[model samples]
Target: MAGATPLRVLIGKVGLDGHDRGVKLIARALRDAGIEVIYTGLHQTPEQIVASAIQEDVRAIGLSIHSAAHKTLFPRVLELLKAQGAEDIVVFGGGIIPDEDIPILHAQGVRRIFTPGTPMQEIVDFVKGLGQ
Candidate 1:
């Protein structure tokens, strides 16, 4: 498997959420771990996010939202991916999401949800597992 494509991930911030410090840290960590990261800066819409992911041909998407809009935004991204025939792209998210909403997000097709304070290594391991 020499010279295989390095796993690519798109890290995005959706909605009016101006909180970006955490997403930047996650993007840096992923890059440090040797994963190629395409970061679509703050204030992106779900359509923009999915379009960017497809254009980048990423293996996964990491969305961060602190706008209390997870219930709307996360599913919108998943739905858009499916509609674009890119459902194979793994979708995951993190933010101020509540524990009670984790299962809801999963049921809506978000593969994983990382709440605040989850270890950085945990996120890295999860993304690395996607490559295998």
Candidate 2:
């Protein structure tokens, strides 16, 4: 999120995903691209992430879950966002997610999904494009 409104973005790690190099790279890239990023380091429950997102008033949420819990973690995030009345917020994720599960993720309101080898510009542009 950028421009005059400066859509806030919450970059979070859900489940037990400890590998965060990719998360840091995306966060840094967003910051460099002039998007304000709120990085939630590691080991975040979906509830906590959503609560913070509502409190911070972010326009989009980018989750970086590398663990196998994407199946479980993804829906909970959507549920909570719906509960918080922020369902309009754009949600997406990146990590070691399987292609089969991606449609399910999107169906649950995940706007984008980037895998390990996906280009960095894609992530930045996708997130930035939300404002458009």
Candidate 3:
């Protein structure tokens, strides 16, 4: 474990969702838990997020989408990652997604979907567990 690299995660906001307070808080929590975080900021396209995740060599990608575009955007990220041969990078998401779409997103290769009011510790633990 002496030479182990710290876990890295890319937290991003894709689409026109300008509200970033939640993603920022999650980023801070992940960093405080010792995970290196790359936040791509707001209004990023799925292409930009996947490219950044691959470039940053992150273990996972956490996307926050509140624009009701989860059905399209989430899978696009997965598709892009697969296209780039980076499918090993775990993909998860959170935000104003509806309950019925949760299973759909999972089926589309999103590892997890955290809704609003989910405990921050659970997110931290999930991301940390990715390195295991």
User: For model 1, what is the C-alpha lDDT against the true structure?
Assistant: 0.94
Give the per-residue lDDT of model 3 (tens digit) for 19-123.
Answer: 898999999999999999999999999999998998999999999999999999999999999999999999998999999999999999999999999999999
Candidate 1 weakest ten by summed lDDT? 1-10
For each predicted model, how many residue pairs clash, with residues at least 3 apart or on different chains?
A: 0, 0, 0
Give the whole-model CA lDDT for all candidates, comma-separated. 0.94, 0.88, 0.94
- The RMSD of every model to the true structure, in order and in angstroms, is 1.1, 1.5, 1.2
Q: Give the TM-score of candidate 1.
A: 0.97
Alpha-carbon runs more than 4 Å astray in model 1: 1-3
Model 2 lDDT per residue over 28-48, tens place: 999998888999989999989
Put down candidate 1 lDDT per residue, 11-130, tens digits, no spaces: 999999899999999999999999999999999999999999999999999999998999999999999999999999999999999899999999999999998888999999999999
Span of 10 residues, lowest total lDDT, candidate 2:
1-10
